[model samples]
Target: MQLTVPDFVGFVGVALVVGTYFLSQMGRMDVRKPLYPGLNGIGAILILYSLSNTFNAASFVIEVFWLVISAAGLIRALLLKSR
Candidate 1:
């Protein structure tokens, strides 16, 4: 099968999310840092945008939660950093 732009976006998003998890698992990433949530948020948004092109209910639902949670964490991290 040929790859579309949306599919490529989804793959990049998957890589970002999975890479973050790998770093976290290896103790190389700090969850408390803004970068963590920021990357995850970006990844989730990319995946969601891709989903908008393909329309997967289950993936869409989970990505929505992931995006929301990531946004919350990013906000918290930023607030902490400002202080």
Candidate 2:
């Protein structure tokens, strides 16, 4: 599958955002304070949005998996906070 300009941009943007988070978590960069499960939820949304623009089935499936896992993490965080 050929990558359209929009698809490439979206894919790269999502990767950058996620990579930033990873770098921050690993102490490789000090971009911002950890947002805990906040970024997890937001990143999942961004991933799904990017997937919407991608033509690759593998990318779509990976994003769907991330979406589900992030949603679960968010829910768990919320429940723990409420308790």
Candidate 3:
């Protein structure tokens, strides 16, 4: 199969998510930091964009929830920082 732009974008999203997890696992990044959820949210959005073209119901649902959860995490982090 040939690679497309959307595919590349999805791959980049995957890389961001995996990279964040790797960093956290290695103690290089904190999961509570804004960057973690930011990366996850961006990654989820990218995946959703790719899914819009491919149209997978399950993947779309999961990505939507993932983005929502990431947003919540980011919001929580910001609120905590402000306090």
lDDT of 1 by residue, 1-83 (tens): 88889989999999999999899989999999999999999999999989977999999999999999999999999999999
lDDT of 2 by residue, 3-83 (tens): 766666566658655776787779985533234445655665665666666557887787677667656766776776677
User: Higher TM-score: candidate 1 or 2?
Assistant: 1
Order by lDDT, highest first:
1, 3, 2
Order the candidate numbers by TM-score, best to worst: 1, 3, 2
Candidate 1 Cα deviation (angstroms), residue 51: 0.8
Candidate 2 lDDT (Cα, whole model)?
0.63
lDDT winner: 1
Query: What's the TM-score of every candidate structure?
Result: 0.96, 0.58, 0.93
Whole-model alpha-carbon lDDT for candidate 3? 0.90
Query: How well does candidate 2 match the true structure in TM-score terms?
Result: 0.58
Model 3, span 29-64: residue lDDT tens: 998889999999999999988886688999999989
- Taking the candidates one at a time, how many backbone clashes does each contain? 0, 0, 0
* lDDT of each candidate versus the true structure: 0.94, 0.63, 0.90
Which is better, 2 or 3, measured by lDDT?
3
Worst window of 10 by summed lDDT in candidate 1: 45-54
lDDT of 2 at 75: 74
